[model samples]
Target: MPIDHKQPYDESNIFARILRGELPAKTVFESEHALAFHDISPAAAVHVLVIPKGAYVSWDDFSANASDAEIAGFVRAVGETARIVGAEPGGYRLLANTGKRAGQEVPHLHVHLFGGQPLGPMLAR
Candidate 1:
């Protein structure tokens, strides 16, 4: 059987269209590895999504297949984007939801960087 490269039982990925520019986004920072944009449905004062340029099924799949450089570049981009969004000094939260169990509505692997105010808590289970 062919491996389903498509995300299993998840909604359409946002990063794909953001890469294609099909959807409008407020991009703060970008690199070869990832792109950072303000979340359309923001949960906090400074809510941004740091997404890898390549489409991955989820965080686990991304970690398994992504190269060292790709991973490093992504991490660096996150820090840069955080500063751009003014989430560094005030502190921020990086969130990655993997599956439905974890409230991952979008299948594409991404890190949500949010701050600029006091976050009540991480993800509520």
Candidate 2:
């Protein structure tokens, strides 16, 4: 079930645990403001998740509170992660599920980078 984005940031969230070094992640890239790692349940050939270093419930929270430098670092980390995972140059897709309606299973903010194969349509409908 998706969690509400407005809810308090859960320190025990999976991503938070991963960040705290309490849980293992297949790290792909890491920077001062972000960390990128391979998704355990990949939706595509190249499904990596890029998340900010700070505790944020979702994109809305991150954008509203994160500093410009933090935001830039996070964005740059995403791009660097894509390049390292071979999802740039050719093509790739970035997806961020912000709210319950968007199927945000995890409360922590994260961007999904998918590529390595032709992703048919943006939506199945």
Candidate 3:
């Protein structure tokens, strides 16, 4: 099954529902620009998803032409979410997968924070 990045937020996606407060999420942190929550399908012991609240589909939607405030908010939200998720003190990894080829099951622009347990090669270049 191919993940469609074009249809990032068509309202049917789980993250969309979460953003709209239509679905229940273990919310870690939230600001005007972003929301952070626990991943229902967690890869690590502590997996948090930090996402912007705008209509931007993916990281491309953000990095390509987001405002300075948007970019700053994104970075700050990711850091705040990491701290809230206990990732700051213990250390964590922030990941944003762009397209289908990168294993981005969801199209929304989100940063995944994983930690609590030792995270090796989680972001190996």
Candidate 4:
């Protein structure tokens, strides 16, 4: 189920577990402030998730609390992850579900990078 974006960050969240090396993830890229990995259930031909290293519950929380360096690093990491997934050549889309209403499943803030084929409309009408 989706969760409230304002909910407290769960240390044992799946992503956190993956970060702590207590769970396995198909990692694609890693930097000081972020980690990019293949989504277990990909939504497109190329699907990867990039998340900041900080304990942020949502974009609102992240923007309010993360250091400038952390912000820049996470942004760069997402871009690099897109490149690593070979999506730059074909174009790509970045999606972040901020709250339960937006379909956010994990409490941790994460961006989904999607590409490898035409993604069609930005939103289904």
Candidate 5:
């Protein structure tokens, strides 16, 4: 499934619900610009998600609409979350799936922090 970047942001999306406090999340970090939480279906031992508070559907949307401060803050939050989760030092992978073809299930723009074990190759043969 390929994501249509032109489509409007879905407020009904699960991440949006979590941001609105309508859904529960195991939050790890929160700031004025971003929120970090554990992924319900983690792919790695330490899988966490860092998302901006603003309504942005993808990386393109975020880079285009979000302010510089928002971008910086969000990235910083991701790093901080990685450190808190013990994904730093040893190593970690920060990933953002822009479209459905990239396996982006949620519409909201988010960064996934994966670590705690060797991630291996980025893609399979």
Candidate 6:
């Protein structure tokens, strides 16, 4: 489904809960602007998620509402997490699904860094 620009941020979302310490996450990186952790259901040998500390419902919401520093720092954290997980030199794929149809299971804005092996094409033929 296409992202609903009007969708309000859900404080109870899984990512939000993790940020609030209400839920446990195997955190890999944390900064004032972002948080990175391992994905519960990994798609690759190395799969990490980088999320903004703020309440952003999607990538569009993040780009539109977050500060420049926040945006830059969050992206940097994604790279940092990838390198820490040994996914940088081998290469990795960064992805963000904006809505349900795009496979976003949560409402919070997050970037997925996946690598540690040949990831193949973007889609199945």
Best by lDDT: 2
Ranking of models by TM-score: 2, 4, 5, 6, 3, 1
In candidate 4, how many Å is residue 38 off? 0.2
Q: Write the per-residue lDDT of candidate 3 for residues 87-112, one digit (tens) a residue.
A: 78978877888777777777678888
Q: Name every residue pair that clashes in candidate 4.
A: none
Top-scoring candidate (TM-score):
2
**Residue 99 alpha-carbon offset, candidate 6, angstroms:** 1.7
Off by over 4 Å in 5: none
Cα-lDDT of candidate 5:
0.92
Which pairs of residues collide in candidate 3? Answer: none
Q: What's the true lDDT of residue 55 in model 2? A: 95
Could you tell me how far off, in angstroms, the CA of residue 42 lies in candidate 6 after the best superposition? 1.1
Clashes of 4: 0
- Tens digits of per-residue lDDT, candidate 6, 28-123, equal 999999999999999889988999999999998899989999999998888888878988898999999887668777888989899999999997
lDDT of 1 by residue, 1-125 (tens): 12233455233456677688888889899899999998988999999999888767677888888899888998999999998888899898999877766667666788999899999866565
Give the poorly placed runs of model 3, Cα more than 4 Å off: 6-9, 122-125
lDDT of each: 0.81, 0.96, 0.81, 0.94, 0.92, 0.89
TM-score of each: 0.87, 0.98, 0.87, 0.97, 0.95, 0.93
lDDT of 4 by residue, 26-119 (tens): 9999999999999999989999999999999899999999999999999999999988878998899999999988889999999999999999
Candidate 2, backbone clash total: 0
lDDT of 2 by residue, 50-89 (tens): 9999999999999999999999999999999999999898
- Cα-lDDT of candidate 2: 0.96
Supply the TM-score for candidate 5. 0.95
Stretch of 10 with least lDDT, candidate 5: 1-10
